[model samples]
Target: MTAGNVVLGLCSYTHDSAAALLVDNVLVGFAEEERLTGDKHTAAFPERAVNWLLDTAGVDPHSVGLVAYNFDGRRYLDALAATEMYAGRDTTRDRAQPRAESFRKVHDRFGSRMADLRDRFRRARVVPVLHHRAHGLYSFASSSYDAAAVLVVDSLGEVQTTTLGSGRRLAGGGCRTTIVEDIADPASLGYAYGAVTEHLGWRRGDEEGTVMALAALGDPTRFRALLREAIPITDGGFSLDPRWFPLRVLAHDYPRVSAGFIAATCPARDPSAQVEAVHADLAAALQERTEQVMVHLARRVRSVTGLRLLCLGGGVAANCVAVGKIVEAGIFDEVHVPPAAGDSGTAIGAALAASLDNTRHLATGVTGRCYLGPAYPRLVLAENPRPGLTAHRPAAPAKHVAMKLAEGHTVGVFSGNLEAGPRALGNRSILASPLLPDVVERLNDTVKFREPFRPFAPVVLASAMADYFTLPQPAPYMSIASGVTDLTRERIPAIVHVNGTARVQTVTADANPFLTEVLTEFAALTGHPVLINTSLNVKGKPICGTPDMALDCLTESGLDALMLEGWWVSKC
Candidate 1:
């Protein structure tokens, strides 16, 4: 491989399809196909994303010295062959065509899809890195520690769903990686969690967050009798009791009718006031139990590696509540979590792992900004303002608008650079007073059109996070959860989730100057450094892409004001 060579990392042909480009070991641009394609959890080839990355970086694919894909086709093929053999040729015959075709298509594309580029440059190499190792790389390499214990948890990364390892910066600026443990087949926390998510009538990969949200509203204790018997932890990992589930259902079928039908037999009540006490207890128990399992795993890693720092990645990292528990336990002095902990980040991981010639790795500070997505120039906004809306350039300036917010005005902010992750950094967010209970309802009904149970997060001045949350570290990416003090929770009830935990994105003056300025103005006026921040989008849509998208939201929703690049518009 070439030193400081450009590499293309693509996680297409599977879930969370995305494209990332690494220029000289630095992540220049990364984006999921779903956002641009407008399909949630898009699993198709990331053609647009790949093209965008090359175009944005002003580099030809031919310039890429290496192309890193997230999985080993040969290993995956072996796993499939084993599954088919075990199922018997007669039974496998019914299921093999589509499965075989999927693998074939990916293989064919990987070999020849970028032929023109290879011809142009001809020096680039295609490298197939194992999926879990890439995941471990993404977490450990991006971490704050020079040496740390790394743990990756996911539904399944190829044949392995979970891996435990140790990673250290080499003495002379290289990286040392070791995999101490691996669990394959039937031993997956993700599968366990996914099973329950399916049992609850959610859309599996897409709706797991919803289950996590809903769990906060119910009693976990009420479901322990049922769940404990269903999912059990063992030396290998976690397992499911056949009484509560059926393994014969294809792994690809998520929350299917068959699964639900099986669940109905082992009854649970629909969410209701009469069942609130039981439901809340059950939710709490499942959350508690999941945390318990994670803690056990963390303890095992610490025991084996004796590392004081820990790094986490994968779909399970999305569980902030569980993450908070791990942090509070004090097992690790420090923990680092990637903002894009899910499959979308695999592209970055794959590229970095494949490009490791000397093994010296450094965590690239969170990409310069989330504004990696397409932008709308002034023309996009001028030509269209949405129906029933008027546009204005502020005469008094954004500082003046900040003054109004400080004085308790609710504002919807949309300006320069849309964020890439699930969290809405300041660019595409609805800013509001955390003190109002009615604000949550209003935002939900008018702007979000989302489940009322969904809660907003607070973007607070980084320096002040400790004053309100039991945070051990500054959470720049809102990657983990922190407890809200009773006093603060009472004051900013709108931002607290049902479980009294908040996924906060701490704003530093250096990282987000404009947002910090607005919050500073608000803090000066109201004596609080936090504002309610929720994604700027309507239900079932991705975050707003343009100023017009922002304006459309403001006029269509019941919001009172819209804040944009140094300007705020209000209805006279």
Candidate 2:
């Protein structure tokens, strides 16, 4: 089939459904379905996201020659069968409805539904890419490095859980990836982390970050031995002991695995119970073991591939603490993780596969930033002003917002395009002074309604990054965690985690002039250029994508004001 200039990528029928549109290898639009639907981590079809991408890019459906879906159900079922055989599981089942039959039924239904959606693009040829391969491609292709060792560790992608590969740009044009290793399903670092999250009375995939936060507060000395027995590092990869964890069964059933593991190892607590020492210790052990295993895998990848640069993808790459440890270990000269490293990012990967030949224009080899979602028009404030709120267009919106932030007031700053990934990088963020320690507690209680243990991130001026955090380079995506200097920690106590490290976003004037202006004004006011920057959304909700959603967040939360583009809207 002849391919067109525009390629549409869709990731759906799984968590964090998203869509991406690449026009002649340039990513013009991308968005997660949850942001538009107001559904958190929704697995539904990303029709709205696809529509928005097409509409925003002004690309006709017929121009989309390739429609790439991130999952291949047939391959997934085949992998499942292989996993069962590899694990020596029973293959016999009820004649009427076997386990494989159930999977096949769902696969057929989903494929049919997807085909129906493909009717919109009459000339497009739809294709499905392997899950982990998509992740690897996105990581390596979006990176600035010409060659790198790619590692993808996730709960499960088809039958594979982890993939180690190498990617390099071809001499002529485009890029190629070669898979060097694969860790099959049931023995996954992502599943292990999710299990630990569930045992700690948190949602599996959604609350792994909470577990990572709690781990810093506990001593893992006592629990490490037990966790090590469950997840042991092997020669090339790691293995989950079936006795300690029924990996095959646990992979499919979330509740049963968490319940069984807790019943056997620790006492199950109430859903709302405060995190106790035991919970913290368990989280600490899981985190420590996971980090060790990841380092082992990364070192192996580096040795095998002889590559200095490392690019990581999959859900496990979202673990900033683990990624930090890997970076600090010096296993790789440089480590790069995309802004959206999880499942949602696979959409970008699938699109890139079809658009690789045309990406020669991206000479820098690096994908720019996370600000690829829809942006609200500045004139919208004047067109549709909400009641009980007054909007004023200041001569310098950044300075006005910075002044509010200097006054210890939490302000929602919604400007430009929304961020594509989980972390908010100033565009759609809530800003506050990081010097006030009480601000963390207030933001948690009133604004975020999240666990206090989860620390806020800091946006620092790029020039001043070395003065604050011990980082090798600028982390524009907030993908790496670095330790704050003692003096810097003293200056900004609220942004420091219990471990004295922070997920820092370094902002440059050229890349983010608006945020840089705000930081400049803030530095004039407080003698520091750092401010607390968190996503502008409440707990269990996706980040605000539109002006109305931003206003709603400001109205519902305890924020003092909201900066929409050049206009400032304050509470009545």
Candidate 3:
């Protein structure tokens, strides 16, 4: 296998498909397919993402030397689809196509359906990585630890849903991951959470965050006994009770809970049905139970590896509440959860694992980076304003933004690079004063069009974060949900949830220069450094990625103004 200078990483054939490029083993660009395709958690091959990354970075397609795909199982699965298409019949029923013909079809299909992508890699060697291993690799490689325990959990990754391992940077350069334990499906803690999400009458993959928000409002004790019995903590690791859940995950099946479990608990609620106190209580129970399992897993990893630091990745790791619980448990001195901790981030993992002869595994301790996607310079944005809008160049952009927020006007910000993850750090965020009494209601009803129960996050100044929240560590990525102080609840009530906790994203001058200035100015004006920061997108849509997309959002949504690079825009 040739480890070449330019390695392109891809995560596809699953939701949140993305493309990441590594020039000389250095991560140059990363973007999700959803961002450009405007489909939330889209599973389509990231054609637009790849094109955007390549074009924005000015990398020639022919120059790419290696293609690293995150999912290894796709090789076997793609062949089945090819065989069916080759014979023009269901391969499972016919069983007539030969192995050679099937492989030939795979080869031909790559040259046709993926013609452009295949031709772009005419001189490149393609490699596949195991899904769980990639998740483990990303969290470890991106962390600042010399060596740390790694925990990766999701609904399912190829086969295993959870993996425990240790990672350490090599003395010479690149990093290495050593696997300790693997937990397969149906028994997965992540699937258990997803099952609960489905049972709560919400979309499993998309609305799990909503359920998490609902957990903050409910009584966990109501279903505490049932959940403890369903997912009891084991000596090695926790396992889901088969009596409560289906043995396997059936595609397109809602509420994969067993009949016995349904009879014991409650019937599955419809998506359109109103969420009641019982549903919230069940959500609270599921979240609490899930946190116990995570803490147990972390303790096991610590005992096995004797490492003080932990790096977490995958879908379950997206649960900031569980992350906060693990942090409070003190299993690790520091827990590193990247801005993009889910499957889309596996693209970065795949590239980091592959090394080139010339580059010494490009230094990718991107602990300070969230703005790492497509960026439009001031020059790129057309000075000519769009129809029905007026544009102006402010003397002090940050102060102007602060002034608008102080007046209770919600401002959409489109500046610098697009954030690589789900959270809108600042560059692509809708900012409002968290001090406003009805800010949440206004944003939910007019702009976001989201569920009222789902609370917005606060982008707080890093130096001021400790003054308000009981966070164990700095959360620049909004990856941990920590309890809010009384001062916070009194001052910035809009961002605080019923649980007296807030998902906070701390910002510093080094992390985001513009946002740092904006926060400083806002604090000076309102005597509060916090702002309600939500992703710059309408509900059910991906975050805005380009100037045109940002403009489209400003026009379609209830944003009072937009702070684009070098220009202030408002509807006439």
Candidate 4:
């Protein structure tokens, strides 16, 4: 069958399930199931997201050339068996027989699901791409560099937990990727990191960022020896000592491994209370060790590939702190981490891999911004105004919002399409003046209801990024953290973390014009072109998706006003 211009991508039955529509190899629509369903890190099938993308793109599902799924269940079974054997689990004929039969049934069920998708789509063929390969493809394809060493490190992807590869743009306009190494299951840095997160009394995958934040408050030297024993950095790869963390029976059972590690290393304590100094030190050590291993990996990749550009994906790539360390090391001239570096981005990678030959016309370089979700009409806000709020359609919404932010009002800005990944990136974001230190406490206590240690990101005008943070280039997506300059630390205390760093998102006029305008106006008012930006949602909820969700966030949270598309609504 000839590959057509349209392809649909789906990622489900794993965390951060999402769907994407690629028309003629150009991504037209994308969204996570969590946003549409109001479920955080949903693993359920993204049927609603798929339907929404199809409707938004005005493409008939039946006409899609291919439906790419970011999983291979067969590989999963192989990895599970390997993990059991590595852990010294009884895998003799007597024990392996029933497991083999059960695996066959599960594999057959996965095959049937793919067949069902094919039947439902009628003319479309369903293709399954290996999870880490999908992540590598997305990282390489979405990057601006023509060739780069790709690294994918996640908790688990099929049988492999980490992949090192290379991607290059073909002279013929397509892209090719080759895997150089694969770190199989049970020796996963991602899982190790998740285990530390669990040990710190945070949800593994969901709260790893919180652990990263808390790391800033502790001294890594305190637990350096313990962490070194847990995860040893090898020559070309890293090893998670099985003694420290046994091979997990289930991928998400990180708490078990975490409990074991904590029991072996630290003093006994209550699990539900605030983090103690030891917990912070452990977090620090884990974070430091992760950065060391990542930098070592990057250096090895560069040495092997001789490529100056590096592209990273997978759950571990979401560690802006580690990314910053990699950049500071100067192992690679440039590094690109896609906005949706996590599993949600595998949808795009699967679509790209399946539609490789069809992507000649797709825009080259970085793919610009990630505002690929649904966009609400301005009329919707006008027609449905919430109570005790006055809606005003100003001549210049950006300027009005900028003035409010200058006055220290926290504003929820919901504009254009929602972002595809975790970071808010102006759209579906809460904005405030970064100069006021109290703003962080306010946002933590009232708006986000998150831990005080969780630092906010700064959305700075791209042109002005160098003035604030010492960065080589613009971080269009909040994918990396950079040290705040001493001036910046003093000027924008709200966004600066205890370690004097900020997860910075630099916006260009071409990518986010409204946000640029708002920053431009804000600069004119406050002599700074930066704002404290956090996702526009309460704690434990997915970022706001629609106008109604934005309204609800505004009313429930401490946001002073909300900018929905072009309509501004202020609480009375």
Q: Could you give candidate 2's per-residue lDDT for residues 327-398 as a string of tens digits?
A: 999999889999889999999887876566345432222366678888876445653366778888888888
Using Cα atoms with residue i matched to residue i, what is each candidate's TM-score against the true structure? 0.86, 0.93, 0.90, 0.93
Tens digit of per-residue lDDT, candidate 4, span 1-572: 14487788888775799998887666877899898778899988898899898887777776788888888777757844542454355323233344345445656778877877787788887888888889998888778878999989898886688888899887767678889987875579998888777766788789899989999999999889878988987776887776576545552323345445666557443456867888888888989999999888888888878888999999999999899999999888889999899999999888887777445443232265588888886455543387778887889899999999988899999988889799999889999998775888899999998888888899999888888999786798899889888779667777888887889999998889999999999999999999998999998899988777788888898889998888889887
Candidate 4 residues lying further than 4 Å off, grouped into runs, are 1-3, 80-109, 251-255, 258-260, 267-272, 357-366, 382-384
Per-candidate local distance difference test: 0.70, 0.82, 0.80, 0.82
Model 4 accuracy (lDDT, Cα): 0.82
Compare candidates 2 and 4 on lDDT and give the better one.
4
User: Clashes per prediction?
Assistant: 15, 0, 0, 0
| Higher-scoring candidate on lDDT, 2 or 3 | 2
Error of 1 at 359 (Å): 7.3
lDDT order of candidates, top first: 4, 2, 3, 1
Model 2 misses residue 61 by how many Å? 2.0
Candidate 1 Cα errors over 4 Å, as ranges: 1-4, 78-124, 248-282, 358-380, 395-398, 404-410, 546-552, 567-572
lDDT of 1 at 294: 84
- In TM-score terms, candidate 4 sits at 0.93
